[model samples]
Target: MRLHPDIPPGPLHEKWDNCRFSNTLVNPANRRKYEIIVVGTGLAGASAAASLAELGYNVKSFCIQDSPRRAHSIAAQGGINAAKNYQNDSDSVFRLFYDTIKGGDFRSREANVYRLAQISNAIIDHCAAQGVPFAREYGGTLANRSFGGAQVSRTFYARGQTGQQLLLGAYSSLMRQVAAGKVTIYSRREMMDVVVVDGQARGIIVRNLLTGELERYSANAVVLATGGYGNAFYLSTNAMASNVTAAWRAHKRGAGFANPCFVQIHPTCIPVHGDYQSKLTLMSESLRNDGRVWVPKKTNDL
Candidate 1:
């Protein structure tokens, strides 16, 4: 089989707009005919499932945690990046894309990176509409903070608990879908395998963590938004339960893993002191807004 990203053909700025206008649209009445199984309820999974259900598709969202809000995304304390340019520092979609590409050593795909920069503002708007309680300025406008590797202040945060607040916003949206009977959520269920039928992913086999029973679920499509595999390092900052089980199962079932070597290191993680330490705690990157990072001149310097 051949792999092709099938990126839309157009100039960088126009590609996304062209694709959106050209893509096929499912009729609203026919949306209910399809069932989508979304594995993992992190920001991506929860938002995708909720949005699809709101568009009239039958969605079954699963999370190993007791609640979608407990997903490892809640550990993200730094803040989210956007190109809103509220600081009037000339930040734009292209600048955000360029900064990210350079920050990643230009290894990321241009199309994907540009798309991320484009939709970032929409994400903030959506979250705000859901009452995310983002930090605001004295004038009652949204606040912005400067993070590393960026000249402009484009990071939007909710005090020091940005991720927790964002997750709550997404959880509220998911719950709204559930209350409307458009989405069914299953917590404490871990995806153990992807069920591919006739070379197409058709369903999944999940293990109920609470019951220790394996259950098979069939769906028209399967969406794997499981979080990263940082815990594969055995002592990273990820939650202990945030293993790569779902991703590994999918890989074993035929899905290809990309850039497995690209692991992000948080420079502010707490130093490991003993063998008993199971995970590293992160010092929020937002601290850099006021604090400076430096090393001691002597080995014993405090």
Candidate 2:
């Protein structure tokens, strides 16, 4: 199959608005008739599941973990960057977009990155409304900090547990949907394959981790927010359970894979000597932000 991003036609700033305006709205009343399957319960999956359920769609959310709260997103110890301009440091959507594009070595799609930048502030507001305890100033304004890559202090965080708090916010929304019967969550089940029907992804086949039984579930649509393949590198900062299977399966069944090499490596890490697959002990990302990363002058001195 061919891959076409179908980027919105317009200027970078107007493309997102045009795209949003052109999106065909699903009938809210008929939304309940559509069963949407969301694989992975991390921030991306959980937020999508919660939002779709809120829109009156029936959602089936699956995860490999016994508890949704335990997704690798919780292990994140840094802050999230937004173009809120809370610091009054001249941060803007375009600036954030440019910075991100430059950080990606100019390889990222400008339209997509621009859209992400435009929605950055809204993301912070939504998470805050969800009761994410972000660090704030003494005057009750949201706090900002300088993180890696960006010169401006646009990073908003809940101390060192930004990911944990954000995930909690998304999880709360998801649980509320589950309680209302709008969403059904399947935990401890790993998606073994994507089930496609009529050139469309309709469902998935999952393996029950506890029973070793294969189960097939079909949906009107499927979403795979199963995250990165960092664990395939053998030694990395990603959670141990994080694997490439779900994404690989999707790729095999007609999905576009982009920028697999765009992986983040925490600079402050121990040079552990062992098998190549052995996981390395990484220091907090926030730590290196406060100080410089020191390297040994000679080989094998770590």
How far residue 152's Cα lies from its native spot in candidate 2, in Å, is 0.5
Candidate 1: stretches off by over 4 Å? 294-299
**Which regions of candidate 2 are displaced past 4 Å?**
273-277, 295-302
Error of 2 at 15 (Å): 0.6
lDDT of 1 by residue, 215-275 (tens): 9999999999998888899689888887788888988988887789788778888788898
lDDT of each: 0.90, 0.89
lDDT value for model 2: 0.89
Per-residue lDDT, model 2, residue 230, is 76
Clashing pairs in 2: none
| Candidate 2 backbone clash number | 0
lDDT: worst 10-residue window of model 1: 285-294
